[model samples]
Target: MEFTITNVILLFAVLLVIAVITTKFSSRLGLPSLVFFIAVGMALNHYIYFDNAYLAQLFGILALIVILFEGGLTTKWCHVRKVLLPSASLATIGVIATTLIIGFFATYILELEWLEGMMFGAIVGSTDAAAIFAVLGNKNIRTKLKATLEAESGSNDPMAIFLTVSFITLIQSHEMNFLSLVLSFFWEMGIGLVLGLLWGKVAVWMINKINLDSSGLYPVLSLALAVLTYSTVSFVHASGLLAVYVMAIFVGNSDLTYRTSIIRFNEGFGWMMHILMFILLGLLVFPNQLVSIAWQGMALALLLMFVARPIGVFLSMMFMKYSFQEKVFISWAGLRGAVPIVLATFPLIAGLEHSQMIFNVVFFVVFTSALFQGATISVLAQKLGFTGETKAPAPYSLELVSIGRTNSEIVEMTIEEGSAVVGKELRELELPEDTLITAIIRGNKIVTPRGTTSLQAGDILYVLVTKAQRETAKQIILEG
Candidate 1:
């Protein structure tokens, strides 16, 4: 069939529908929807010409900005704070370790140059944000572990990006010596950190104080802020990716009007970008070429999942209070997704030696990760006793809002099994003055709290609290 405008539109509509259905069945099948997305892209490759790595890189960069922004916007600062130091170590040191270990193996076994091997390692280094977010949403992992995994996945992209770009420069000119590389790392990360923190505050202030005339324009304004942060930071030779994540987190946690709407918008937008990005990358691959790299791909994937990742996790968390089982879970949770494939585009655009080989190997590793790790994560959690009864979705809707450092705020939370708030009477919980449990919904029943009312494991509490008591209320409920 010859291509036409109508046909293209219909094809896109079909793919969108398939994307939704793929997500609906993803958890049931123990497969991340990413597999289905990439499969679609591969299927379409025969019908279209999408072998342009340059174009793919541009689109990938934009999609990643959106993904990281949404990640920051949705993450709670309190949870991030708990895992901040350890997760930061993993994002920075863990990445370097993974890259060096994998790079050494690739250099020895594959007979590649040291720099080329490192490039391949750096390309596949990070745990993908899109994959982790999608898979974890369906699991019942504990709060701290989940937060650490999320924080690591969300923040580690910059390290991989730095390594990839640095190696590409070295492979091209061979002039970027060790001292220059170290200096570049500090220059990029230092600028990124400062700009991200500074702009995050500015973005939050703008969102809260701008008070757009139409509610619809608020999300648009937020989107603009994200793009502006990334582009402006990148132009100054800093890590724009890091800036987006930091800015999103700050704005997400701030007291802004219509915050929920902004979050909802970004979630939907991020999903669309994920779908499009994966499909496009898939379209760029030639399955026939993948056959030649099959054995090498499998070997590298196994070593990554079994050896290198565990080493990185154990070393990174050495001084932390994680148990053996928790370390094992984190090691197994290093599922690669689109990030590596997108990074592969860097080498391809750089026109370096072995670039195509690197791309093919990365595609295969991502496939294995999605098929193996993505499928087994939930089961592994259960095996290690890290999972509890999955929280059921809230049956009713609620929204909380306050303005300008006011003491009044609304909080909705599910009382997990074994949480401190569970099995305690409202009076015994000893909530702060002016803090009220407005209502408790258990299963399908709604109970107005009495002094003697006892909270259950599955109880969903609608709390109205003053700012002074917000942190205290959260500590009480989530302490379990």
Candidate 2:
């Protein structure tokens, strides 16, 4: 049957509708949305054979950029700053350790060639940020632990990508020395860092300085900047993914105009990308091929989930003051998702020897991970005493709009059990001149707060304050 544009549109629309429905039920089923979308693609592939590794790899790269951009944009700086050191160590040194351990397993146990083993290690080393964000973001995990996981997942992709590319190059060229490869890695990382930082500052500056007539256009501007950040870094032979993530972190944390709007838009966009990328990756796979490697793949996946990942986490975070339960949760939270499958496409695209084998193995590993680890992460967190009741979004919302360079934001706080605001009258607690308590909600009723009105636990308060005053306000409310 010949495919036409009309037919394509109809088919895509149907698939998307199916995806939307699957997503609605995903959380209830204890499955990741990628699992459903991928299953749909695999089902479709039975009737329509679509095996274009290069195209799949391209789309995966693009999807990763969007996913990481959104990850960065949504990350709260206050939380990230607290765990930055440990998270950075995990993203960098943790990735290397995971690769070596997994590589050794693949080489000695699986009897794969060293280069192929290394490639496999690199492909699946990093926990997928999209997967981590999707799974843990819904859970009521401790803020610091969640931040650390998200930051590691968001940042480690660059290291894994670098190692994968280097291994692929090593196999393909066979002439590049270890010293040369090391230099190349550093070069990519350093350039990406410089470009990302510069572009992030520039993007914040641009967003603040240029006010679009319509607030709707701000999302577009932000997205364009994000794309530019990735592309500019890539053009200079740097890590484009890293650049986009870093750029988004800077811009998202800054007090740019339409910051809230931009974040909301990207959240939607990121989900779309996730669905599309997973479907494409699923279509690229041959389920029959996965069958042959199923046992080996499961072994590798188990090895990664139970052994290498735990070592990586424990070693990277050993010096930190995290509790044993927290460390265990961190170790178990290394859920693989589309990134490994996506990176699998790299070897295929590079035309490396045993590339198909690598792809199929990676596919099985990712499936195992998403099925086992992803499904049980929240439960494990709860069991390990790392989780609490998930916080509900505020019943209502308010925000202070910025016209230009203002850093003010509408901040929301819940009156915790021991919060200083819990028993105080509004008049007793001194706040900055720029800050104001817009409204308070207790249970289902809105309390019109007066100077004499006493605050109580469980009340939700929304306050407007400059960026500089946000921390101070939180302290006063929480610790007064």
Clashing pairs in 2: none
**lDDT (Cα, 0-100) at 233 in candidate 1:** 95
Model 2 lDDT at residue 307: 92
lDDT of 2 at 165: 86
Local accuracy of candidate 1 as per-residue lDDT tens digits, 183-292 = 88888888998899888898877766664445556778888899999999999999999999998998888866566768888889999999999999999899999999
lDDT of 2 by residue, 1-480 (tens): 457899888888998888988887877766677888888888888877899988988888888888888889988888999999999999988889999999989876657788879888998899876666556656677888888988888888889989998888888877769888888889888899889989999998887667465656778888888899998899989999888888889888885656777888898988888898998988988889888888889999899999999999989888998988898888888888877888898888888778898888888888888889878887888888887888787566555354344556566677889776678998898887788887888987888878898999888887777666777787787677
By summed lDDT, the worst window of 10 consecutive residues in model 1 runs over 400-409
Report how far residue 162 has shifted in candidate 2, in Å: 0.5
Clashes of 2: 0
As for candidate 1, its clashing pairs are: 407-466, 407-467
The TM-score values for the models, in the order shown, are 0.85, 0.85
